[model samples]
Target: MGTMGMQGPQPLPGISHVIAVGSGKGGVGKTTVAVNLAVALGKLGYRVGLIDADIYGPNVPTMLGVTRQPNITDNSMMEPILSHGVKFISVGLISPGDKPMVMRGPMLHQIIRQFLQQVLWGELDFLIVDLPPGTGDVVISLVQTVPLTGAVVVSTGSSVALQDARKALEMFHQVKVEVIGLVENMSQMVLPDGTVLDVFGAGGTERTAAQFGLEFLGSVDLNPSVREGGDRGMPAALAGPESNLGKPFFEIAHRVVSRAIEISRSESDVLEIS
Candidate 1:
């Protein structure tokens, strides 16, 4: 398997960036950031794949409005569902629509392993992984087993989420996983006259990122369209990139691409010296 003994993570092939979009807590728009970011990357002409790794609360199947199950090939590889010009595979798509997953750790590991080894993911420029909230065993297993390029931490600009976000970052550090940076979701509200409101008590995420010497990718405005789209099983970023809320996701995508290039270059320079 490609994941086995993944050789030093040296600028891996078949995919340029494998980013885990995660948060310290749920309800902080973690998956929303992930799906929209994948769409935004696709819009920028990079072939992308979205993995709904949130095994427990899988939602990509619904967020992208994908209801059909993927078919497995004779070789045992399953085709990923396609939506909004991006490829996807999710636990949400694995189970029947009305059922919830009750798998244990071994089963979770097996399913995750299958997601990697049994899915014929095409050569993608980016594979954005939407992880479940918090620093749990699943997250640790993924970091230990997968060749992640880096991770993006998502959180609201609130104290409670920030506390958890800090813990999440610490957990990533404990596992020697490099954190790409922080993204403040639902940071503010934009009004009709182009004014911004610090409704969630602004700047908490920014301050945390600054203290950690991490880049603050940027903040996403809380838009009614985003909520409405989620309710209607549509990702808001696809509907209108020009919209106030949708625009941030695109911008964040660009920033992440730039950060990735910088990291790759630095790593390359280090290799050259040795």
Candidate 2:
């Protein structure tokens, strides 16, 4: 721990696939997707790590059900908490809910750098970074610290989100980061009669992807499982691989794995990090 009781970085890494999952704005379910995506990839038997990059609103710890403070060594490195079979760390664990991140840009950058370089994330296959809504200091620090494997943008089927989603992609472009694709979250609602109601609307993610020349990962239904599983600290992909919501997320996981989208290593160098 630092002199001010601030959590520092993890130990040096033997990890791959540091992904940045982001949203143009909040309420787009970026955290939900990030948590479940890590869990889904873990199901493939990969050693996964989830870093709650949302310094302002640290929700990944809650979604991952990590409540314990990270352990610190005399060397000032943090040992991430283990939960849901995945190694994890979050600023939320260090700060109470009442305290928001009001530090200057340098402090924020330092905190992000600590998480990336100093943490002891031993031999992880994938480190899914759940960035805060919108492009800001956190995202800048993350991408600036290390070259990311790719970035996954989460958006809804609304023009408002769509507009900001474009800006989000532009942020990635400005940073020279790869845009993996767009995920259409809360795609629809499954009626009791087994019909699909496009509540948030349909094809918004697809349209956005088409315009940006990025692929459309898939659509996530507004299943209660996403909510319940998140609250229970189990990703929906674990509970409902057969459910409507699960199908899309699982498929997205497949896409991420199949194409070798992230990770700079060769096939021989690639081992399931989990």
| Candidate No. with top lDDT | 1
What lDDT does the true structure give each of the candidates? 0.83, 0.80
lDDT of 1 by residue, 1-49 (tens): 4667664323335777778888998989998888888888888899999
TM-scores across all candidates? 0.91, 0.88
lDDT of 2 by residue, 1-274 (tens): 5678754333335876777899997888998988888888887788988888787688877788767789898999899888767788887877847688677889878888888777888898788888888888888777667767778899999889988889999999998777878999988888889898887767898998998789788878888878888887777877646766566777888877654543355433555453
- TM-score, model 1 to reference: 0.91
Candidate 1 shows a clash count of 0
RMSD of each: 2.7, 6.2
Alpha-carbon runs more than 4 Å astray in model 2 = 1-13, 243-245, 262-274
Worst 10 residues of 1 by lDDT: 4-13
Cα TM-score of candidate 2: 0.88
